[model samples]
Target: MPDEQGHPELEEIELGKVLAALADPARRRVIKQLLEDEAGAERHCTSFGLQLSKATRSHHFRVLREAGLIRQVDRGNSRMAQLRYGEIELRFPGLLELIRREKEEQASSET
Candidate 1:
């Protein structure tokens, strides 16, 4: 949705929603995978090795979308999901970096 300024209007996505979306390890893995891909390339949700039911997978994507962390677009039979990296970085600088660092720390601790 665009405001009068012709720029994409970022709706005030709830912090709770964002946190809820990030709370799941699967969702965090999804975000980490998306971040690994270079900008401008759209990723299909099924490309990830997430062992979730179809409905659960949809729910995860929906939460991420509603939280404004990702932008999903329909491309015929497949839907493409992309990280809103630039917009999110501008809105909350260092936030994603912190999350990634935490993920790395957790992985290292488990090893």
Candidate 2:
């Protein structure tokens, strides 16, 4: 990856933080959105537009980074977030896919 100007790579993150971060619905939505793209897809944390406080957003991202779910770097004025696809896949096989499928099923049913 091109480092997004200032973000740490996946190898620099911790694992436990990622899990704790994803344990929440809001944070899980952030991860799910990022997973929609290929590797190195830089997105703003707020792109999820979750109804959360700014502090909460930062806390969620921090957890994801520490858990190894994402790699974020400062991009000039805004922070860019990217999912650690390969790293996460290696660590947990088919986990993302399964969760995403479940989420889709839930959404469909809700409609």
Candidate 3:
């Protein structure tokens, strides 16, 4: 698979990198948003509404893309992101579901 702007190839996606990417609360939020989107829908970076500077936001996106958790494509003047759910599931079955469930449980406990 062609790496987009130096993003990791599917075969090169390491568990450590994925776990590290998800370790950040901000990145997890991004993943949660992508998971909530309808299948095959792409989310624009600005649509995330993350309270972060442009450089920081770009860094998070880069981490996600590099971890192979998301695919980004340049559309006109904007960059769109889509979760690579299928690819990740193939490589790490049930991983996303587990993470989502854990996050939900944590949220409920804090409420």
Candidate 4:
């Protein structure tokens, strides 16, 4: 079960859901960016610079959050996002490193 913030606990993270969430190229890009950013940095939704509809991007963020890949909170008028790196790493070793290594070419698709 997820917490009040809608984030799943480390022990509650399911691999199938995580993989499904990561399957989308756009979502993967989100993860990749989060991975590449400074540790513990919480980025705003607009900071990703995704040339996508606000609704579409919000969907992506929701997917990542529900899948336990990231955490999000309302910051002022916008939402702030951060990779659940340590939690994910504790549950699945080296998973994020693989995302980081994924070729940047695939992230070009804005959808």
Note each model's CA RMSD in angstroms.
Answer: 4.6, 4.9, 2.9, 1.8
Residue-pair clashes per candidate: 0, 4, 0, 0
Q: How far is 77's C-alpha from truth in model 2 (Å)?
A: 1.1
**Residue range 5-111, candidate 1, lDDT tens digits:** 22243556556766787877778778888888898579998987788998999888887887878888879999888888887787777877766666554633442
The lDDT ranking, best first, is 4, 3, 1, 2
Cα TM-score of candidate 3: 0.87
lDDT of 3 by residue, 7-102 (tens): 677789999999999887778878887888887789999788788999999999999998999989899999999999988999999998866766
lDDT string, candidate 2, 9-103, tens digits: 55654456555666677777787788787767999888887778999888888777666677887789998898878877877778778556656
Superior candidate under TM-score, 1 versus 4: 4
User: Candidate 4: global Cα-lDDT?
Assistant: 0.89
Residue 56, model 1, lDDT:
94
lDDT of 4 at 23: 88
Q: Estimate each model's TM-score.
A: 0.80, 0.75, 0.87, 0.92
Best candidate according to lDDT: 4
Clashing pairs in 1: none
